[model samples]
Target chain A: MNRRKFLKQSSIISLGLLACPSLSSAFSLGANNDVIIGHNSHKYKVDLTWGNLNPLHTPVNDCHEMIQDSKGRIVLLTNHTKNNVIIYDKSGKLLETWGTDYPGAHGLTLVKENGEDFLLITDYERHQIIKTTIDGKVVFTIEYPAETGKYTTKDDFKPTETAVTENGDIYVTDGYGKQYILHYNHKGELLNFFGGSGTEDGQFLNAHGICYDNRNPQNPSLLVSARELNVLKRFDLQGNFIESFNVPGALICRPVIHKKDIYFAVLRSKSAINSDSGFILIMNENNEVVSCPGATSPSYQNNKLNELYQTVRLFQHPHDVCIDDDENMYVAQWNSGKTYPIKLTRV
Target chain B: MRKFIGIIIAMLVFSSCEKQQKEVTSFLQQGEIKLTNPRITVSNTLIDSFVTLKPEIHMEKLSVGYEENGKTPTEASTKLHTTISATKPGIYKFRAFHPDWKPSEVTSIKLYKKGHIPNKITWKTSANKKYKGQGETTLINNQKASLEFRDIEWVGFDTIAKATVSFNRKTYIKSLTISYLTDPKSWVFPPASVTLYLNDKDTINVTIPALTEKEIVKLDDIKIPIEKEISTIALKVNNVQKLPDWHAGKGLKAWLFMDEWIFN
Candidate 1:
């Protein structure tokens, strides 16, 4: 049949399938019927109704990122000006919500210093990184690094994510604007900057996420996500390129390290951006893909991993995943119709 | 959205045991199992000799079904396992299925046979400056663009686009296939009409149907058959002058994107 006829028939068939209960029931699973996803030992039981709240009261647009606080609270950051930050407990119940000032809130990172929890929120519209207390008190803000001579105006510095070091240093990724990682001391002074937007080995296309990798305390490094290129890049403390991991077919948003594993919220599968193709990826300490929830099983041949793609349509542009103490995953999505985060209880 | 609700209702229908059904329904009501599009990798889309389709199927309970004649892939179609070789030129569609989850949306790729390569092309109307791909060498380069409309291989035009394609010599071209992109979400629609004048004498015209709903980004091919030998061809493609009322940009001119033209 032609394209037009095929589309017409498919819609009719969809209507017919909806009317026939028995035909649709063929998709139902027996034996406990919990929606289990992921591969290997990292499998999880999906909980779609987690963190749901009234949109009129606690509205969210593009639930951008999530982080587990020191007290085990799941703090979600969204661009919705009504409530930019929503704090939820592990049980998916809303504990508190704050911040209408962060209209472009996209990233959330919780850092503990001297027994106090601090939240680093990146606002792309404001073109600055705001450091605030866990209860929404502003501490300080890091504006666009005009001292580095790399930026012409404030609009050229759309910071997407930030990573802080143990010695009170800051690393900010200008992902949306110019793709540079600006390093600063605790005083918010620009020390240096590197990794501009280019095809070079050290540069990036969309340096969307960054995290201070202290996996090996002796030689700590920064793991950055070049989203459009589908690669995780490692840079030393002094802005030196260390190595890169090529993850084909997975547009990873951020690298979240929990225990000996590295978790990434794959933004979209394949090259279609708005196709609602996304999943969760877990990698071992050796950078080997162990499990991909809602995606194909991980496999490698001759040390080169195969391209990973989504198999289950459970996530729509998963931007971040926060692993709780019990290993439950709270996934925050982007462009998912203002829905709340979906939690994955580890089985 | 109905498909998502159907899975929950079906769970209530299939779990025959009362106790097991209760436990299942309670947990499943909070969630629904919606499957993603299965990944299909073709060795090459520009089919010169033969192409291999390798689908990654991990579990035995799941299977990939496909159709070659431009039909939507269903579970009842031919099951694809291991690797399949295709020597002929046609569009191959694939979809994955499992017992407990909704079947995936169909993924397709068109395999075109290598034909006469036109060396030169002259432009009559200009492409949009932002999307002028490689000047005049864009259409005959045989390179495929990604689903993103910003791909450098695609030349975009919002008005009538006219061009003259020239062959190295007087070539006997049986048919000409024009490859274009349709991403309605990006306000890029298929051409309203594509008129081709073969040797300035014979003319063939094709009109694409108006889009009724939202469509996923795709690269489509339309073949216009011309049996006679041809030396030069003039092509005129008209954009959708007015988008339908359902679209957000209703009554506005829609953009037209063309990447490559294959002659066979």
Candidate 2:
């Protein structure tokens, strides 16, 4: 039978079993297999290893950011009403919950310098940047100063994500409220700010994500995710123009660097306004897409073909992604509305 | 025997007179013509220019008026200016119609001799004045509300310098007070301007420094007297000339930080 027929029959059987408590467990188990991977698929193998990190006792509203610290612990940042950051271990056990300070926390990063780890959080609601510790201690706070020449008035600025270099230089992307990257010195001093709101080669429409690449050590590059423009621009240490790369997907959230490889957690734009399934894309140093199993199929309108590829799985709004030192990937989803962090181990 | 008879006759007359007087007063009161229950119904019929499947509807009607005459009576209208009054307390149907549109769903209101006062307005902010950093500030009045940005970075036009205010909800927001800290040396344009969006639509645009106090444009939409509620206010700066930096000809190291928002 076709996939639709199979799904229909399975749904009927599951609905009928819902009335029987004992049969419910069996039905749930069968439902897990309902995710059918078609032949000749490029999607990666994703295992729902662990979950259940709901702190407010409500379903997770929006998992906008996620990262892994040096200790291999996964930290998930959500845009829920309270308890924005939820920490979990590799085994999916809830370790701790923090970040009641930020209501609309959108982006999160764990900056490791020397031997200390600093948690950098971006507040989309308040339009400020905050640096704290893993235990939710506020180390430093940086509000938008009155010295940036980019804003004409005081009401047009909202910062979404930030990137910090090894030398303590910080670059923050004002994605929502304003379109400029405000640069600050290591001491939280406004050194200078560059880039304006535009659709030009160097300018950005929505500078949603950012990262500092210190691979060369001598000259670190600032990789900015110009989300609306669908391109990532690389800037030199002095904020000079360098290069750009096109991201395959539309809604690219965050780019995580694991060793030399860059993994982008991309949400495929649904044909309809709010369709949610998306997947992850891994790219190597050469910018070539590293095909993996369980990646979701590129969906299109009026197309009934089920392109169940290995590299593309059924991911509903993949917001942020992080990889451990071992190249294991963790993705936080948005529309899924669950606080559980998804894990993808490289086979 | 004469005295006893006289006492019984007097008691009966007094009792009969009292009963007749009560009947006459009751008849007069019932005959007085008055709009017993006057009510008004308001609704937001469209959302995003489309007919909302579930339109928001509210009704206000009660007994709080006096009889003008035995046939003519008047009632106080609701704040919306649309009202209906009944000659007597009973189940009344109200329906509103928009030109070139289908009639709204009929609503039945039961008028009584009692009325309820409007709900008291309560306001709250996700991040108040004492709270620093970025978060949503909500002002709630009844079911209608609005949201304002607190401590958010404002960038556009030229560049925002510094903004400060203390929001007081003593009355509904009659006007949004914005204070700017711009350097005269960095004033590229003599008149710096900004626009405020209520819901993605431009509602107000005003220039800074109010040189004559009348230079500021009091927006019409803003005159509706913002209800005690939370509304999402989007501020955008426009027509600003990029000023040169004082240190060098390069762009100035200027930023805009909103310290507070005052809705008065």
Choose the strongest candidate by DockQ: 1
The residue-by-residue lDDT of candidate 1 on B1-264, one tens digit each, is 656655564444444334444445434432356566666767767777888898878654889999999999887899998799998888799888887687877888888887788877889999999999877888888776766688898999989999988887888889888888888878999889899998888889888788775747778877888887888899999999999998889999999999888888
**Range of the 10 consecutive residues with the lowest summed lDDT in candidate 2 chain B:** B138-147
lDDT of 2 at A199: 78
TM-score of each: 0.79, 0.48
Q: By TM-score, how accurate is candidate 1? A: 0.79
Q: Proportion of native contacts found in each model? A: 0.31, 0.00
Query: What's the CA error at residue B6 for candidate 1, in Å?
Result: 39
| DockQ, candidate no. 1 | 0.17
lDDT of 2 by residue, B45-144 (tens): 1112211111112112222222212322222312223233344433334343322122332333332221111123222222224433333321111111
**Residue by residue across A190-230, what tens digits does model 1's lDDT show?**
89999999867799999999999999999999999999898
For lDDT, the strongest prediction is: 1
